[model samples]
Target chain A: MKGNSYLSRKLHSLLGVIPLSLFIITHALTNFSAVEGGSERFKAAVGFINGLPLVNVLELFGIFIPLIFHGVYGLYIAYQSNLNTGQFSYGRNWAFALQRISGVITFIFVFWHVYQTRFQVAIGGITHDQLGMTMHNIATNPLFFTLYVIGVLASTFHFANGMWAFLVSWGITVSPRAQRVSSYIWMVVFVLVSAMFLMSLSAFRGDEFKEAAAALDAIRTIV
Target chain B: MAETTVAKKSIKFVITRQDKPDSQPYKETFEIPYRPNMNVISALMEIQRNPVKDDGNKTSPVCWDSNCLEEVCGACSMVINGKPRQACTALIDKLEQPIRLEPMRTFPVVRDLVINRDRMFNALKRVKAWIPIDGTYDLGPGPRMKETKRQWAYELSKCMTCGVCLESCPNVNERNTFIGPAAISQVRLFNAHPTGEMNMEERLETLMSDGGIEGCGNSQNCVRACPKGIPLTTSIAAINKDTTKHMFKQWLGM
Candidate 1:
């Protein structure tokens, strides 16, 4: 805790605070775009992302780094916590399990996403993305579509959840009144965003688009 | 029953009594003569000694829990005059005539004033809101916190697992499983310690989990309701920043 004078826990939080949120918002916006433009528009957005000259580096950081840090940091905290805290009661220990599980799910969702969209590289063979082709594939793949829906729902929930959590980490979720208000807000927003994504997937009709559609539907319907 | 009947001046009570948790709770009336500057608990104690209702029928002694009458134990908490607080500390002189007493509904009632506080305790466990320490073996000054820092650390340490905060939180209802604000504040407290920081990321991560910190609705009631005046909202905000950073750190491998 005392290693660097400049880097207290507050600073560590600041490091991820903005960027992690940015990722969620950007991701939400991009996913929402699917409703207006269909797969083609989504791909166009993808094209826009790929064309940015210096953006891939940022995108790479956006895509990979935060996930690693947030998820692993969560695990490390959980691991160390179990060792240190006493044999805790139910309320005390539930968060540790829930956090790790959500982390793992989000992590898996990302890899599966990369592979399905042909953005995956290194783990197997590098799969390049032809924007239009990727778009077509998503429209054509039922499984991918289903996953997208789930991903969207999960992502929004995660973000909404993160909002309340971020407050606490900053030493802010202090008053019971404030905590209640913030959490209720998060709950409402999460459900709304997730529902929007699900509606889109469900509206997509056709065998070719069934998987993608199902994914979207799943996102909306997930309780 | 009349032999043990303690003389009373004239105290009024509008009690919400229920035969069962499912039974539609109804108001019952009682007027025990007032003793000088009596606490709400003392009045209840008098009622327990004489199981007679205002209607003149023998009934069971009113069931409630009270230990350390000083309120540190928090067992004497209940809704008096429509506000959640310690009955033992609620002076009869300050209360309106026909004082209203009801059980704290945020928890399941085992009897009249005794409600299960397992929910709050469970939340603490969920957040891993403690620093691990081995048995007392002269671990001798494991870590020294600044007196300045200890001031607030001690602030958060005052939570007595009372249901006041949870009861005041609108989000913490039957519809949602949101762990109320107390546990969130506790997370901030434990994570701030030198040894406690070892699990900081874990605490942050837990807040990120479903029915975890996400459940907080930020009504700011907990701070207002906390008898110890713990800063519940501030802890939530701090945890918010911490968890986000923790998220990005995990993803970025930072």
Candidate 2:
């Protein structure tokens, strides 16, 4: 019997590289645009994305499908595997365990985020500065601010570490030195991306989007 | 209180049994007269000789696989007292009873304690975990490796294909086609050899394929489960690095 289940493994890796990672990196960078470019750049970017033809189909096929697959498949893998970090406690072992843990957190964060924001805009008929106002309101709340920070960290860590794993498993970075180089690069990515996400969140904490958020709050109160 | 003069000197066992590969497995209890310094294998032998259950009914001998009566063969590997290891080396004195013996469920159980370890062997085959030899004639005194390299390679060569590592591994399940740690480690061993480097690309390519190295979730269970203390995770890391380099070479047509 051919014992090797190659398709699932390849698909998981492929999905991580393509739509999943691609979407995540783009999403993070776009959100980071709020750091200096203000709400106009952020809203413009969101508008551009929302203005695309077949935006619903593009999201369902290009983003949601891949994200759900990668997230769910990753969970199944984590479930089947035994954690030995408690016994072995090596750096690589810890990294392995942390990857799954971060994956779970990121999955939850991403889902909750989309539910609170995306669905509200798409299905709930809430729009016009939806991204800016919603995020600003969320950050103003202490509990949600903490969650947003954690979500940012978790997603960034997942992407950065996942990139290293992707390179190694795909036979890209084969030498110890190369693997180390990739590790260093990914670590840099984690820090920079995390800082960018935090800075964007911090921008929301300011009064720049206060009017938009207060308008939404008044609408919510009246409804 | 009434005092008893005869000390109860028996070992209790709760063994998982299946009459055939497709049979429904059930637990069968056995109590055997204890002997000092006896291991699980010896206790099993006593039960085999008696062919009787703890309830005084005659039954077939409790079946398991073992050879060399030592930890080397890997045939004797099973889940003893909840840990996967060679039963021959699991000293009864050290284990808590009633000892539980179960077949390594990672592979198909043949009958009772005998599991088809073909998965592991096939994985080794998949990676071509060997140095290719042209003929039976003397290829007299092949290339000598450095002493330090030979020492580590010898350690990697100690794997007996026992399937314990696979049993402990979370990634090696029915749901996935991971080749497991043993084969990956073996790839490292062969790739380190002077002659083996000729087939290095082939081996690396095999690992780069679907059920290959990418399947590793890095649980770190295999290293702890290896009876020979082989640096399995280390080998995996090394091979992971090597395969990427090999892919680069292949892409560059070097």
Candidate 3:
């Protein structure tokens, strides 16, 4: 009885890894589409995106509903484990700490992303897929570019780390050898996702690329 | 002053002794014939057999809790050489000369090495870390989960309630009533359950209250310190998202 609640709350948080991770992957793909036609193409993509009733409506339910459930469950489970398993200490406390921190980073990122793109387009009437044109706008502004790169990197790490933890919670990584192997696998996936996401961003930033390429060429000549 | 001898003599074990939970703790040193493979608990057992300190002082046997002997039960945890770990797993050979043992300070000392963990137990209770089934009648199979989701839930369940995590947590000190990482991860675990979704609103509301998830400062010490390797930091992050949505719902009266 008591155990069931504890398990259910934990499971909900674990399931969250799926939706969040999947959302990022889809987002990165959509952003990559900007590399073809730049701003105008990106705007068309945004129109297509906004037109997709299934995605927009589902996204509202997907992002918020699970997020709220996960939060409440996190609080409850944290307290419950504190009770039944009275052996509380730092070494035993780290895993939960990481899960929560990554959750915070992801949440902050989501809010900012939605504000910059979704809200802007809804209110200011965007001329392009503000979300997709992120690459172009970032290319124009170096500060935004740096922030974008960091944000994408952070998202990838959180997603991969979440996936690994989720797997452990689900009892998939059994045996010492298997655990190490799976960790390596998850690491590779994280790096790949991050690199691909960054690549797409860099590709669309045509002017930034030209400047960076010139700097590299100068360094090559000097060295 | 101590002197070194080259002779093939056995090592000595000087252990603290206590009877009941309310009794005063005392020290009793034992000179056990040097055995290569031995632990604090093993040496204590030897002393228990002879019931004599090195100075020929007879005393009551030492007592502690230990199970699995493999470091999983976390019952035999104690301070060895100024660090917390299982006495059963702490081998004599790996320890420095005159190994020192003491009860974990975070908990109330029960006897010699045993301490009361009631505080932590109460913390878990405060969070209501369990699913309410409503009855003893067997409710045939709950909602099914996709394979991917099931795998992750198993990972969060690996927590064994070892206090080492809390011992290392800075937030879990006397100054704060922070519930710590174990409970937070457990919240992530149960909230992931199929039927558990129903009570999600209730759980998020709890975090919004005093001494809840807001206490976390993003120190990230809990992730590196957990022995079970549970993803605590990630759980903390996931909850942040949950809380924000919850807060939004409250704003609109949802």
Candidate 4:
């Protein structure tokens, strides 16, 4: 029973980095295309992903299943942590507490973001081409925009800090100096990834995305 | 006149006190005449002798455990000025005013500053943190270790089981069974020994269980808070690698 938990804990750490972290990186890149080449490029990126053979299979195994396991097990781990940052106010101590806090935040944000987009599509509420329009609607709403910003920041921080823990637990960064260097690298990652997500959000609020969505709607009406 | 004025100056101490194992803890302030080069132990002794509160009321002597006044003996571990360390080494001159002394709550507190360290000892037992040898037969000379290896291993041997590493860890509290960092590092120390390596697989197996190596959250606080300057996080990482291999070996039925 104990050995089972050991494997499960390691698997939790591994899954966070392997498919989940990779998915976050790719998802950010796909979103960032909106900022770089307007809604057309964003649509193309989304279309390219949706058009892939075995896309549903990939989503199930690569994204949804891993996400559920990581998110649920992460909540358990968070519950087990005894946060004592008040007494031990060291930087790493704060980071430990924040890791758990951000894990919960990211779990909520990811689920809500998915429900707003993918689940909406499943129910035939919107077409894949209207993803940019859906994002635009979200980004322009004051409450949802604020929530997205907080969610994006929280998710990025969780990933970056989690990567640092992953390196240590997996025996990659063994020495203090290596751990110190790894922290700096991960902080940079946090900033860069956060910038990518924020820029994409801002792009959704742009007039070009509205025009693109309107054009897509017009073509649908004509058809 | 200057000597008289210096004699009047006093040091203030705020100690968290509990009358019994199950009693609620409370704070008591004491003022003792200033002395140069005085450590926390000496101040505590002053309070014990006089047994007077800052309010000028008589009280029972504060109880604490100590053997060697030096930092070598791990018995005098406590939280001083919000850091878990040896009270013997916490210099009054270096500490902030109103030096706060509290029992290390990571273990169950027996009295004022005395805590039961059985949890740490039990963790050591769980990991079998010792080299086995039969006493009946004359075991011949042990295999020699390389000088370089001995040097690093000596650093690990300095651990007095003071429980400071455990006290500083956020994961080693009442809510969880995590064995904390001290025992994990001990496993690393003993496993490296020539004779001790005989039971290396057994130790690694223990580390793969509940309240074992996987319990570490990699907060890195234990390494920072260790008074003996042991490379604890390094040991944990080494153990993690070893456990990974062990887990695979078991999975492959090897």
Encode model 3's per-residue lDDT on A127-208: one tens digit a residue: 3433444445655688877777767776787677667655544445534355457668878988888877887777767664
Tens-digit per-residue lDDT, B144-202, candidate 3: 87789888788888877777666656567565556777777777777898887667777
Candidate 3 residues lying further than 4 Å off, grouped into runs, are A1-4, A7-11, A14-18, A67-98, A125-135, A138-143, A168-182, A208-223, B1-76, B81-91, B97-102, B105-108, B117-254
* Candidate 4, residue B178: how far the Cα is off, in Å: 1.3
| DockQ, structure candidate 1 | 0.11
DockQ of each: 0.11, 0.33, 0.03, 0.71
Tens digit per residue, CA lDDT, model 1, A1-223: 2232113333434434567766666655665556777655665666666677877688667656766666555443333222101222232123324443455566677667666554544443422323333444564468877777777666666666666665655656545566668778878987877776675555343233445445555766995
User: How do all models score by TM-score?
Assistant: 0.54, 0.75, 0.51, 0.96
Q: What's the residue-level lDDT of B154 in candidate 1? A: 93
Ranking of models by TM-score = 4, 2, 1, 3
lDDT for model 2 comes to: 0.84
How well is each residue in B94-147 modelled by candidate 4, as lDDT tens digits? 999999999999889899999999888888999998999878999988898889
In candidate 2, stretches whose alpha carbon ends up further than 4 angstroms from where it belongs are A1-112, A115-130, A136-212, A215-223, B1-6, B136-140
Per-residue error at B36 for model 4, in Å?
A: 2.6
- Which of the predicted structures, 1 or 3, would earn the higher DockQ when compared with the native? 1
Residue-wise lDDT of candidate 2 within A1-223, one digit each (tens)? Answer: 2333444655677788898878877887788777778877888888888888998998998889988988988887777666656545666667788888898999999999999888898786668467797888898899999999999898888888888888766656655577678889999999988898899899888787787667767888999
Please list all clashing residue pairs in model 4, or write none if there are none. Answer: none
lDDT of 2 by residue, B70-136 (tens): 8889998998877889999999999999999999988899988999999788888999988888787
Give the per-residue lDDT digits (tens) of candidate 1, residues B56-134. Answer: 9887778888888887878877888777898888999998888999988888877777778888888889889888877
Q: What's the candidate order when arranged by decreasing DockQ?
A: 4, 2, 1, 3
